[model samples]
Target: MLYFEQLLVNGLMLGAVYALAAVAYTLVYGVVKLVNFAFGELFMLGAFITLSLMAPEISLLGHVVPMPGLSFHAAAPLAIAAVAALGALIDRVAYRPLRNAPRLAPLITSIAVSVLLQSLAQTVWGPGSLRFPDTPLSQIPAVHLGQVSISGSNLVVICAALVAMAGLQCFVRFSSLGRAMRAAAQDTTAACLVGIPVNRIIGLAFVLGSGCAAIAGILYAQAFEFASPTMGFTPGLKALTAAVLGGIGSVPGAAVGGLFLGIAESLCAGFLPNGAVYQDALSFILLVLLLLVRPQGILGKKEMNSHARGSLITAKARKRASMVTAPLRAMDRLFASRFFDSWTFRLLVLACSIAAGLLVQSDYWLSIMIVVLVYGMLASGLNIVVGFAGLLDLGFVAFWAVGSYFTSIVFIDVLQKQFGIDVDSVWWLLYANLILGGALAAVCGAILGYPTLRVRGDYLAIMTLGFGEIIRVVATNWVSLTNGPMGIRGIPSPSLFGYEIGDSRSLYFFALALTVVLLFCIGRVVRSFVGRAWVALREDEDAAQAMGVPGTRYKLLAYACSGFVGGVVGVFYAHFQQYISPASFSLFENILILMLIVLGGLGTMIGPFIGAAIWIVFLQLSLKVPFVNSYPESRYILLGAMLIALMLFRPSGVAAKARLRLVMEGV
Candidate 1:
């Protein structure tokens, strides 16, 4: 009973910080309807900022600074202020320009902002976890009540959370500025008509939200006595889950949800065996369950069904076929006229690419080409869902992870466990695992997709992300199966009738063949009735359903097909490396796959291939450069800048114009 009481106290303290962060998400999402992916990084920044202010002195460019340390009282406000200003700056710079753009534009931009912030933080903080200076809280002793004990820091956290939440509630309920925010959130156009500063209100929302996150960050640092660049991601993700659980737009809901999630996590960790390792996954499971049962959230009102917007290439098609650019348009028409559209040109390009791959003698270049092929395969699969079905699957790596694990378990672990065989005797198991792994992944996809039948857009994206995280957590914690992060090793490579695929050249050809097969399959699907149905669904879900298209069936098919492609790539990946690990599948990997598809041209057949080629080449070449090679994190900044630039100048991507004629002709 005493232990249980301690857990309860700890849960309440944790819940307080989560509530602050959740409120931050709810506040921004209420007005902007954008799930600021960068909010996590904002929280991380707040902690670092607070650390800087609280430290007595710090090193800068090999020079020591003699700045005096501020107490928590003074530092907290400064940290909050800095983060809040940054939030407003993010609005003015990254989001404001994309206000009228498609739903995907702002979301992608937010991810870029997140990457940029994390990279910047890493650059400044040097990627090491630092301890907070010895403050009163750390020095103060614990208080005991019978057998139950609580620390001063815990009390501080709980008290600070209550004060902050109460203050926010009062401000939002009674203040004129708060009412203006409410008005803008309800209807931006109407608020504008009523002379409310809509833009400023939106900025204020970000400010208030980021301010809350800053408080959460400081409180977290105080309670944990540590700060790190990557610390905010898990907490922020759980808080987002809480926001969704309670009712995303409801302030009260956010608090309630945070408390619920915090308590649940604590109880699970304390009571369940091996629960501590899986505690992070609990919030995601809750999020998925809530999204399935009640997507409006615990306190939010019922929302309308998600409506698909339009094809990614719709505007690009118009520009290419438009008479506004007479010479360019005429040239495009001529290119599509006769010789350019012939199979001869297409085969010629294909032959050239094949020749280049075959002739490349450098093992390093061959390895890069193999990676490009694998990424192209992943991107192609992702395109089927994000591009064709218009589903934003941030958890695409989940399928890849599942496939890899399944292959390892079947071929390596099972053999060792059951048959006492260290080496795989039957090479046919590779082919078997490919089919088995794909089928397993497809089933998993169907399971994930089924729950998300009613949810769409950003909500669906979060759920998939949670599902993905859950997979990783399970892989990390299920020690008996996955070996608990030491990772599975000694997996055998593939062979076909005695010709082994152990070398880079062989793997490159293997990957290239698989990419060709997957692309052909995807192409055939896109040109068929199912493809048209997916396109229709992407354009408008209701209209597609009204037209007798089975929305559920097509959507499920898209997911299944996507999982199959990813699974195929995964099996090859496992064999090529002859090893597997949870680290191989991460959120960043998922993001990279999506970035390639989006950067190339969503929904276009050749876009993923081109995007993968460009990305892999750029990454390889960039790493070899002297300056950038030194500061490797700088590449993320460049990628983020590229994403922002792409959104602004080429939303449909560089290949969308070329893909336009093919799509039109198919339709």
Candidate 2:
């Protein structure tokens, strides 16, 4: 009984924090009918800002409080306010312009914003975790009442959350602006028919949501005691789930969903054996169950917008056409054009490039290059889903890991030991493994897509993210197959006809060749009928459907294609590295891959390649630079600042519109 009570208290405290984030998500969805994929990053920024402010030398007001002595009461409110401001700024810059665009445009913009923000944070904070000073509230002794012990911080968190919710409820009900905002949420045109300033109200909603997120961030810091560049993901995803569970556009529903989710997660983690490892999976199980039972959410009302709906159908047809024919056209044009008219010249250039790379000679540098190629492949695969199909996939790395593990099991376990096959000659294994990997990932994709395709925008992003976590959890805890965190090792490198390509120079060429081939294949697909369908779906799902495009079929195709690419890349990744581990394919990997696609330019052929090159080069350069490497913790600060600047100046991407126009002209 006492244990249950403690669990309830802990769950409620955690739920309060989730509620704060969920409210932000709900508000944005309510106003614009779009999910802010970057919402979690905003919460992360809030916590980091608080940590930076509370750092040793910073002074609040006229007096300086020693960093070691910073109190929760002092830091929490300020952090919340700072995060709120940042959130509003994100809206002003990234979201506001794209508001009038198709739903996919804003959704893509949100993803880019997320990538830019996360990268900026990583640069400034140095990709390392920071520990905030433990506050007085945490130090307070726990209060014991009837076999239940509640810590002071937990109680404070719960009370503060309730108060915040109540305050919001009152403002929305009684304040003039709040009423206007509600009117806008219900129907923007109807609200505009009155005197409500829809845009301003929308901005205000963002501000309010951001502020709530900030509070949640501080509360989370107090509870967790550590903050990292990537910390926002788990909580952000959970909050999104909460919002969906309660009905995304309903404020009261979000609060209820958050609390319920928290309690459910707590019960699963605290009571189930191996629950800690499986906690992530439990969230998805619940999400799938809920979605299957209630497609619109517990409290949501379905009101389809005709314009948005029509757009989706048209978009779907275009995507389908592109998928089927684009690849062949691209290949034919490449061969016929002056750019690749001479195979001899291309071969000569490749030979020289390989020679030059070999002469420079650092295994570390070679390894980095290999890593870049691997990422390039992963980014390319993700582009099919996120760029072409117009889906925001937060857990793409899960498929990458799937391919790696599949190869490992087949080559190391079945072929080598059982069949007495020579592990050294693994090239044949790779070919077979890649095919199998793609198939497996496609199956997983179909499974994830079946339920999620009904929901568009942010809901899809969150569901995919939850699915990714479930895969990771299974990988971590399925001791019989995965070896349970011990990870699979001693995987052999690729060997073609008994010639090993494990040598750095040899592998570089091999990887380069594969990247080129994959790029060609992907480029072709992008110009095909299927690719056009994806773009159409992305641009406007309803419109695409109305044009006789089958939404479910096209979406499932995207999932399968994306999974296939991811699986192929995964097979190569395993053989290239000759090692397989769960850690290599965590949520961070997902973020990095997403960043490449967005920073380079989503839905473009050359964008991911450029993005991968820049990211890899910068990462290597950061290591060499004394200032960056010396204070690793501060790197994310620079990254965060850069992201803010990038979004402010180049919302589309680094590539100029003229360049894309030229490419289109060539095509």
Candidate 3:
């Protein structure tokens, strides 16, 4: 009884911190309807700023000046102010210009911003978690309540949270600026017409939300007595879950949702076996469940189901669309006059590239080509979802991970543990694994897609992300099956008719062959009825549904096909590397894959090939360069900058070819 009581008290206090962060997400989402993926980074930034400010002395441009450290009270306000300014700056730099662009543009920018900020923090903080200085505040005594004692810091956190919530409620209700914010959130055009300064109001939303995040950070740091660059990500995600659970866009809903999430997490962790290891997974599970049940959120008034598939058909997209189609029109004229059509020409080009790769006798170059081919295949598969189906899947790595683990289990565990057969004796299992692994991944994909595909836009993206994280968490914790973080090793190399493919050169040729087969198969599918249905769904889900297209069926089909490709590639990866590890299949890898497809051309058939080549080659060459090798992290920073630049200037991508045939017309 005492333990339960203690859990309740702890849950409420933790919920207070989560509530503060949740409000930040709600406030911004309420007005602009943007997810602000980088918001967590702002929370992290605020904590660091407070830490720096509380330092005994500050250094500027190689000069250090003696200074007295400020108390928590003084540092908290300063950090809030600093972070608020940074939030406003972020809006101006990353979000503002892309306001009227395609919805995906801003979301992608947010991701890039998130990466940039995280990378910057890593570089600044030296990749180490930090602890607050042993200050006067942290040493305060605890308050006991019938064996449910609360620390002084936690009490302060709860009190401060209540005050902040009350203050926000009062300000929003009575202040002129608050009214202006509400007006703008309701109807930006109307607010603009009424001279409400919609732009400034939007900026203010970011500012105020950032301030709340600052408070959340300070309180979190205070209670925990430690801070880290990544400390904000999990909490930020939980807070978003709380915001959505409470009813996004509703202040009161966010508060209740936070408490609910916190208590649920606390109880689950306390009572369940190995619950502490899986605590992070709880938030994502809640998010998916809530999105399925009530996408409007618990208290949300509006549906908040903004679709993105066809939303990109704005003026900018049309302009890009025309540019995308121009080369096709020219090709049509050329193909009409020439001996072969565009399709035949493309086949010939592919054949030539394969022949050239085959002609390369050097093992090193073949090894490099193997990576290019693998990523290209992965990118192509992903393009089917993001570029053709118009689903922004951040969890594509989940499929890859699934495929890899399935194959590893079959070859390593099943062979060794169950059958008691040496892996080397069952070289033929590789073929079976390839077929079975892909089938399993397809099944998993169907399951993942079935529930969340119904949700629209960023909601779907977030849900998929959660699904991906869940897969990783399960893989990390389910040690009996996945071998935990140590990963699987000593897997036998794949062989054909007892001929071992142990050489890098042989693997390269093998990977290239698989790549060719998969690309051909995928290309044919893209030109088939199934592909047209996917394009129809992407262009407009409701309209497609009206036209007798099963939105659910096509989506599941996309996932299955994409997952099949991912799974097959995973098998190839496992054999090629002769090992498998969870670390290889991370969220960052998913982002990198997305970058490949986007940088290449979203829906273009040839885009993945070009994009993968450029990215892989750049990475390989960058490491060999002296200056670049000195600053390894600069590559990601540059990539982030490139994403921002691409979104702003050329949203169509580099290889956005004009299609001669329309997939929507069953071409």
Candidate 4:
């Protein structure tokens, strides 16, 4: 019973900080209709800024730098102010330009901003945990009530968060700007027509949200006595989930949701034997279920789901196509011809791939090509979801991971270890598992597709992201099934009829064959009615539904097909790498695949291959540069910058102006 009370106190303390962060998410999302994925990085920056202000000297960008060394009270406010300003600037730079663009444009831009911020923080802070100084707040004694005790830091966290929530509630309720924000949230065009400064109101919301997130970061730093660049990831995700659970736009509801989540997690951890291992996944699991059941949330109004139009891409194809440059327009036209869509061109590409594989004798270069081939497939699969279907799926790698793990466990753990059978003798099982694994992954993808029926835009993105994280968490913790951090090893190599694919050259050939097959299969489908339906959904889902295109069925089918491709790629990757681990399928891989499709071109068959080649080749070439090799995180900054630039100037990407073929296919 005493232990229960302690858990309750701890939960409350945790919930307070989470609620504080949730206010930031709710504030920004309510007014601007964007879930700022970079809000986590903003929260991260708050702690770093506070650390910089309080410390006398610190290592910044690999140099020892002098600091303000201010007291906590003085430094925190300044840090909050700095972060709040940054939050507004982010809105102006990363999002405002994409205001009229597709919703995916802004959402992806936010992720880029997040990547940039995290990488920058890691570079500045040296990727190591920095010890937080023992401030006056930390030095205070604990407060005891009967059998339960609460520390001074916990008290500070609770009181400060509650106070901030109250102050924000009052500000939103009574202030003129708050009324303007509410109006903007209700209808941006209407608010602007009514003479409301919609842009300024949006900026104010970001500022307030950032300030609150900073407060939460400070409170978190105090409680933990340490700061790190990656601290905000899980907390930010949980806070966003809390905001969704309560009411996206309701201030008090954020608090209630946070408390509920914190208490549930704490209790689960206390009672369940392996709950602690699964705690990080709890919020995501809850998020998926909640999105399925009540997407508007407990306190949210129906108007909160105004953007649920069945498609994340909210722009007309012709309008977007018209913005392409003259040169790119010519390229698009050249690629739109019957020759480009024909099997002859595809066969020529396949022949070229075979020639390259045979010519490249070096193992290292062949391995790189193999990676490019796999990633190309990943990009292609993702394009079907994000480009053709117009859904923002952040969890595509989960399917890939599913395929990799299934084949590995079956070949190694089940067939060999359990039955003591030789895997090489039953090489046919490999081919069989490829089909079975892909089918299983397709089923999973369709299950994930359910949220697309109800959730849209950023909400849909979060649900997909949650699914991805849940898979990662389970893979990392379920030692019995996944072998935990040690990972699965010694998987048998793939083989053909009486031939072995043991070398990199053979693997390259094998991978190239798979890539060509995938492209051919994709081409066949995209030229059919399914492809037309996807295009219709991408351009305008409601209109497609009205046209009897069966938006629900086609959307779900896209996910299944995409998953099948990802699964096939995963199966090959497991054998090629000869090992599998949770780390192999990180969120970065998903982002990288998305980047490939974005950089190449959306809604185009060959775009994924082009993007993969450019990105993977750039990565390889970067190794030759000493500075880039040393400062690895700097690459992400470049990536983020590129995404921002592309969004601002060329949201259509490098290979744009995709023309739909009424006959044998191209999108």
Candidate 5:
């Protein structure tokens, strides 16, 4: 009874914070219809800034600076205000311009903003999770009510949350601006026609949502007595789940969903075996199930469903977008010219590649080339799903991880360690594992695609994101199999027949051969009828299905093919590094690969290779900056900002033109 009471009290406190954050999500989602991934980063910023304000001194770029040492009451409001302004600024800078563009333009930009903010936070506050300095709120005594004991901090959090929600409700019901927001939410065009300042209202939504998220973040941090760059991601994800559970665009539903989700999580933590280890994963599982069963959510009206799959472009915006992409279109024409496909260009490229490989005696440059080719393969595989099949898979790296793990386990763990067999003698198995590992990844991809890819792009993206997180979580928690973060080390490099492909130059050559062969095969595959089917799906699924294309089968086949390529790359990656770890395969890697595809040009054969070269080369070159070298975290910030800029300026990418063949009617 005591345990239950304590858990219940704890649950209430968590629920309150979640409810507050859910309000933030619901507010912005109501107006923008975008999953502002940056909300999590805003939440992160709120906590860090509040703590910084309260601290006596803080470190900046390895320098300790004196601080004001203000109290929580004084610092929190300031932090909230600052975060609110930042949230509005972000919406203005990153989202507003792309609002009328294609659905993917803003969606991709939102993720970019999310990554940018997280990296900025990490750079400012350092990468480590920080313990908050002791405060009066954190030191507050627990008050006992019968069997249940509630801390004063928890009580404060709960009371403040209720007041915020109540005030918000009253504002929406009575206030002019609030009413305008509601009207805008219902019908933006109608509100605009009726003389409401839609942009102003949208900005206001960002401010309120940011402020609410800040309040939740600060209170949550006060409870835990810690702040971290990564702290907001889980809470933000959970809040999103809560928002979905209650019904997006419904404040009351958000509150109910948050409370229910918190209590469920708390109870699960207490009752379920190994629950603590898997606690973070539970929300993802719930989200997937909820999306599958009832995406509209409990309180969300059927008519309120606003997952717009089509372009939201207006006439003026289209003109602006076209103007921005004119340069890319020109570049596209350059690539489409006869000179590009001529033998002279091909020979020049081949000669240059060979000369560079031979002349660049330094291992570092060779290693860089190898990395570029590896990522090119990854980006190429992802292009199959996203560019060709028209499925935005945010979790493509999972297949890479799976294949790497499969070979590592088979060669090192199963063969060398367990069976007491010498791995060197059985080097031939590595070649076979490439095919087997790819096959394994193909199966996994098909399985994942079958259940999850039935939804629209946004939902499919969410599902894939969840799938990626699950794989990561499993790799992290499953200690016995995975060795749990310590990682598997000392896997052998690729041995070609008798000679080991161990040197940087040897590995470079080997990787180059594999990359060229894979890309060539991909080129061949994309020109085939299978590729045509995939492209048709990419263009319009319904039209293709109407034209006798098997949407499900073809989509699954794409997943399999892409997975096979990723798995093959994974085998190479494992061998190349001579070590395997979860660190190499992260959520960010997926974004990087996706960015490569976007950078090179979606649906272009040469785009992935070009993107890979540019990304890897520039990433390596950026290290020349002393500031970047000192603050390594800022690289991600730069990359994210570049992604945003790319989405804004070159929505179609560098290779905007393609050698598309006309399909014969009735064929």
Candidate 6:
């Protein structure tokens, strides 16, 4: 009874924190219909800022501040202010310019913003956990009620959450600016017509949301006692889930959903076998079930549902109707011309590029090249789902993990145990694993898509994220198959007809060949009729269905294709590293993949490749640079600053124009 009571109290407190974070996500989505993938990073940034200010060694005015004085407690409020400012900045920079662009443009920008922030945090914070300075606030005594005891920190967290939520409610319900925000959320055009500053309201929403998140971060750090650059990923994902579960656009709903998720996760951890380890999985399961039953969320208005569905239909119809017969007419004209004769020159250029890569004998360069190609494949696959299909999938790494685990399991069991295959031959296992892994990934993709296609936008993203966490949990705890956290080892490399490709030179050619094939296939699909249907659905779902475009089928196809490619890459990754672990497929990995796709340009064939190249080069260079690597923590600061600048200056991404042209050209 005591344990249960304590668990309940802790759960509720945790839920309160989640609720606070969810409010930020909900506010952004309420007005803009965007998931704000970077929202989590905002919270992360807040925590880091607090840590920086409170650290005893760090002096603000060229003098060290003694512990537990005004400087220590002041860190919390200052952090909140800084994060709020950043939130408004994010709106003015990343989202404002892309307001009228395609849905994918903003979605990609959010992802880039997320990566840029995380990377910057890493650079500044030194990639390691930072402990907050001990203060009297943290040393407050615990309170006991009957058999259950609650710590001062938890009590403070709960009380602070309630106060913040209450304040927000009052502001929205009674204040003029709050009314303006509500008006904008209800209808942006109407709000504008009424002379409400819609853009400013949007920015205010971000600021308010960010403030809440920052406070939550400070409270969470107090409770958890440790902070890191990557800490935001899980909480961010959960907060998004909570926002959707409670009705994404509703302020009260977000609060309710956060509490529900936190409590459920706590209870699951307490009661289930290996519950502590599988807690994340249980939370996701609850989210998926909740979405399946109540897609609109617990406190959401019913009117929003019809509006969402109608918008999807209208967009799909417009995009499909505009493109029908146009592509066919162009194809007929091209067939009568000398377009085919140009293929010989294209092939020659491709051959020359391949030769150039092979001639470079530097193993280090080859390894980097392989990584870039693999990421390109992953990014391209993600683009099909997010860019063309307009689904915000944050669990892409699930497919990657699925592929890797599948290959590892198969190689360990079937090839070695039953067939008496040589495990030492890393090359043969690589090819076989990739083929089998892709098939398994497609199957998983279909499974995830079947139920989720009914949900759109933020709801879809949240559900998929839950599904991804479930996969990770299973991988972590399924000791019999996955070896638990011990991870899988001795995975092999690619082989062709029994010829080993373990050498750097051989692997380079193998990876390059696969990348070219994959890129070509992606290009062909994007140019095909099916690809047009995907774009039409992305633009407007209901319209596409009206045009006989089978929205669900096409969505499933995108998932399957993306999953297959992710799986293939996973197989390559497993063999390349000769090891696979649950940590590799965490939510951070998913964010990184999304970053590559978005930063490069979603919906463009060359976008992922270019994005991957830049990311790999940046990562390698950052690690080698004396200024960045020397400090360890400075990289995160640089990465965060860069992301903020990018959002402010180029929300459309570096390759946005080119990607838009490619998609428009196909149309």
Top candidate on TM-score is 4
Please give, for residues 323-392, the per-residue lDDT of candidate 1 as tens digits.
Answer: 4334444544644455655678667867876897789999999998888888888998999999888888
Instruction: Assess the local accuracy of residue 296 in candidate 4 as a C-alpha lDDT between 0 and 100.
Output: 75
Query: What TM-score number comes out for model 5?
Result: 0.92
Q: Between 2 and 4, whose TM-score is larger? A: 4
lDDT of 5 by residue, 450-554 (tens): 867545645577678788888887888888887778778888888867688899889888887887788778878888999999877776677788999998899
The lDDT values for all models are 0.82, 0.74, 0.80, 0.84, 0.83, 0.77
User: Which ranking of candidates, highest lDDT first?
Assistant: 4, 5, 1, 3, 6, 2
- Candidate 6: tens digits of C-alpha lDDT, residues 1-667: 8888888998999999999999888887888888887888888887778777766564322345444334656887888999999989878876787676545556656776777777666654556787766756678899989878898888988998988988998999899988898899999999999899899999999899889888888778778988887888888888988887898889899999999999988888889888888887776888888778877889987654432442221122112222533443453453334442356744874796588676888899888888888888899888889877767787888899989898888888677776888866544656666778988898899898888966766667778878888998899899989988999887766667777678877877778888888777877887788888888877667777889998888889999999988998898888888899999998767877776766666666656877788878877788787866565545545555554444344443455444532234345
- What would the per-residue lDDT of candidate 4 be over residues 559-636, giving only the tens digit for each residue? 999999889888988998999999988777898899788878777887888888887887788767787688887777
> For candidate 3, what is the TM-score?
0.91
Off by over 4 Å in 2: 37-74, 97-145, 189-195, 224-231, 304-368, 415-422, 425-427, 520-529, 622-626, 632-667
lDDT for position 57 in model 2: 56
Which wins on TM-score, candidate 1 or candidate 5? Answer: 1
Indicate whether candidate 1 or candidate 6 has the larger lDDT: 1
Instruction: Report the C-alpha displacement of residue 245, candidate 3, in angstroms.
Output: 1.7
| Winner on TM-score (1 vs 3) | 1
Candidate 6 vs. true structure, TM-score: 0.87
What is the Cα-based TM-score of model 1? 0.93
Off by over 4 Å in 3: 57-69, 306-309, 312-341, 348-352, 355-366, 624-628, 658-667
lDDT of 1: 0.82
**What RMSD does each model have against the real structure?**
3.3, 6.4, 3.8, 2.7, 3.1, 5.7
Better of 1 and 3 by lDDT: 1
lDDT of 5: 0.83
